[model samples]
Target: MVNLLLENGDLVVIEQSDFQQLLDVLAERTYQVVGPTIRDSAIIYDEMTSYTKLPIGWTDVQGKGTYRLKRREDDALFGYTVGPHSWKKYLHPPVSYLWRTNTTADGFQVTTAIEEPPKLAFIGVRACELQAIAAQDQVFLQGRFVDADYKARRENIFVVAVNCVQAGGTCFCASLKTGPKATSGFDLALTEVLTGTNHYFLVEIGSSAGADVMQAVTHQPASPAQIEAAEALVEATTQQMGRTLEPLDLKELLYNSYEHPQWDELGERCLGCGSCTMVCPTCFCTTTHDTIDVTGETTAHSKKWDSCFTMTFSYIHGGNVRTPLRSRYRQWLMHKFATWLDQFGRSGCVGCGRCITWCPAYIDITEEIRAIQESTNKQEEKIGGKL
Candidate 1:
């Protein structure tokens, strides 16, 4: 809690010194501030106490089989891109206890689980990652079998999204129409604008809670030049992206490429390491397990995150369904771009490009899609010749 004072005026144009007030305001409301911090040589989401914890003036270079943090020329709080961690780490945790039971001498009764969710305030969230959280909401909260833990956590979220000022080497959110700008599903959205001798955020109010938080900080009305500068920076980021995924007709294109040889090609490169699923914000598969004490006096049931890349993920009584690497890869790709539409009415991938950057084998999904499309075109050409 850094000491900073604001005068009696409209709190709209906040300065860097006043940023700490925003966290203090959330803390006063009993909302724990969870945000990005540089650890393990990567920017990760963790419990943040002050503005000093933010990775200021740091951006990252991300590509297939590559990632490195680099210092920026100017001081900007939200200049960096996303890392291996996503908001789902808090909203939908990797592990949680379902319920526990203790045996009684006379009789036994099942003890159900009831855990209250935390009041969370997420800082420095990106637009594509926000879209990823919305997609996860459809999986956990909107479905018939609502995940109680996820629902509890989702209900109490307060998001502070940041628009991208610089695109990473593997970024493609523009192609997926998901990012470079914060559009919706955020409480407060900010675009960091840094001009010569001027650095400020063009803040946009998205929710009542956001407005309440704004009251705690000191701000002034933004000039038209500032707003235009913000827009220009976002457009620059969009144009500087390192990859692209064609969104038009993507569903049908993937759906019809079931037998594409690219699946076999990528299967050879894919390590089945589950890195993509672990980094992906939208991958929400889980498996539950029960643990009993040695004396059998108590039992505990818990659920944790799982991945389709595992052979046992599709296991049945007989054996694994997707045993082969090719089949497993096909299932993952097709489900993300094809069948996910039929199930969720939207593409599962938000084009965050974590799968492309963090992969040990450099297995790029965009390249796979391109190969499939080329193969499809060749087959169509052959058919035309036959006709």
Candidate 2:
């Protein structure tokens, strides 16, 4: 693999063919290749063979609370923003069997479940996703109670981050200070460069493992002009986001606006179907249950994704604290924008906009924040008038 400095001064370039070959080599080494593909007219992550399965000439139109697919002028793989799915599907599965129990002469015997970590090569991961992974790392890996299952899978995974060349209308990653360019927590990073004369990807190695993969591929040294083009592409995407969040002190804003009227407005339209939490990359709440087969002799316990919007989520001994729809809505928003930072040292929402797009009622978080800001301004005006 040829390595040359690009104009960005921080990036390196590898030929597109070389990048494709590297995936083949990783698969040969027992990595399950995961990347973006066109599924049901939207870009979703799935197992891929080579680069042919990637979403080509596909881009998404995202708004405050809408998403649509549109054709692109050229066949550029990884051309779209995130869809309903994220890398969490593979890293942390929807449902997993923790263990099993069997009836025995002595009563019952429990067998602990053993999981073998699958070596994974995640292709086309975006900057915000990398940040989400890092945030989850703090929760599952570094906490007092470490999740063995999550730890095993995380250790065997390899990340390949892609600098976003296009932004969705619902995206506020720039306002959240998360994306448009990958900063860390990846093995390799790629920037897709498409120009009038040349179409290639500028690659950069983030670790020794990525460097080894680069060595096996055939590549030519990247020129400075190519690097500049890639940087410009990322910059343009950052500027193109359709939605923006005000630069408010999130912690103070949420803490003080506990009775904001926006929550009541959202509660009326919200179905509380939990679709937003299901599609969100960072919502990790879960519930457990035990089920018996028709025979009644065999039983299994399972855990599945859960959300704060549900009535049972806030259940106490005899009643639920957040019984009202407005309270549930406020809990969700406050947890995401305020308490999560205190608990996890990061915002729970990654600004991916999946919640906005997937919500049937089209509730936009950015717009909600702006409404709160407007309300706060009016409240301050009334206090001044009283004085």
Candidate 3:
């Protein structure tokens, strides 16, 4: 396979034909091949035994309030945008057992939990997802208390990233400056190139492990023309993004917008159902609860995903801190765009737009931001006139 390093120091690529062979080899090594596939009319990640399991000849159309699948004339793998699932399900897990308690002669004893490591090869990873992974890393790994469970799964994963050839209507990664092309945190990267008479992939290797995979595949050296073609594809996709966020100073803007009236308007339509947080790739909040069987002999404690929209999320000693729907909406938006920067040195949003697509009431974050900005500007103009 043509082995060229891209601008990112941690990704590699292989030709389409050779890529199939690489997958077979990785499978033999016992690494579970997880990639996108067509299921229930949408592209979702599942166990892939071979290249046939990939979502070939399929693409998706995504918007602020809609999503649908379309068939492509040519067979191409990794041609779709991000779906409802993310790598977090595998790494963080929706539910996990912290520990168990048992009755002992003297008292109750708590037993430590044991987790097995699974070798994972994640295929067709997008640029926004890479950033999402990085954001979770901060929450679970780099914090004061590192999550042992998350750390183990993350350490065992091998990422195969794909540069977006087409952007979803709901995507705003370009505005967040997180995607359209993978810049880091990948072992390999690929750009699928399709022309009138040819279909192939331009591959680049980012890590030693990725180079080892390339050694197993048969490929030819990429020419200058192919490299140029790859660059042009990325540029076109970047320009095709359907949603855009303004270039205001995000942190200052959101912090100053706490009292904005748009929050109340959005709250009226919001169901407070928390679907957006569930679909979001970067949301990492969770809550814990205990359960007992009917026999009363068995008990278990579990941690499940949680959202800021829930009143319990903001529970103080006596009552919830943010009581009104407007306050809850304001809290979620401000934390994502402003406070997240202060905490992680980056915005919590990767611009995947799941927040817009999956919301039951179709609350569009981009439109909300614009409305707030306009209202704030008008208020400022009136104040200046009075002065």
TM-score of each: 0.95, 0.94, 0.94
Ranking by lDDT: 1, 3, 2
* Of 1 and 3, the candidate ranking higher by TM-score: 1
lDDT tens digits by residue: candidate 1, 232-294: 999899998889988788788887777777888888889998899899989999999989999
lDDT (Cα) of model 3: 0.82
**True-structure Cα RMSD, model 3:** 2.4
Query: What are the runs in model 1 whose C-alpha is more than 4 Å off?
Result: 1-11, 385-387
Question: Model 2, stretches more than 4 Å misplaced?
Answer: 3-10, 385-387
Whole-model alpha-carbon lDDT for candidate 2: 0.82
Query: Which residue pairs clash within candidate 2?
Result: none
| Top lDDT hit | 1
Give the lDDT of residue 169 in candidate 1.
83
| Model 2: lDDT of residue 272 | 88
In model 1, pairs of residues that clash are 13-219, 13-220
> Which lDDT values do the candidates have, in the order given?
0.85, 0.82, 0.82
How much is the lDDT of residue 49 in candidate 3? 81
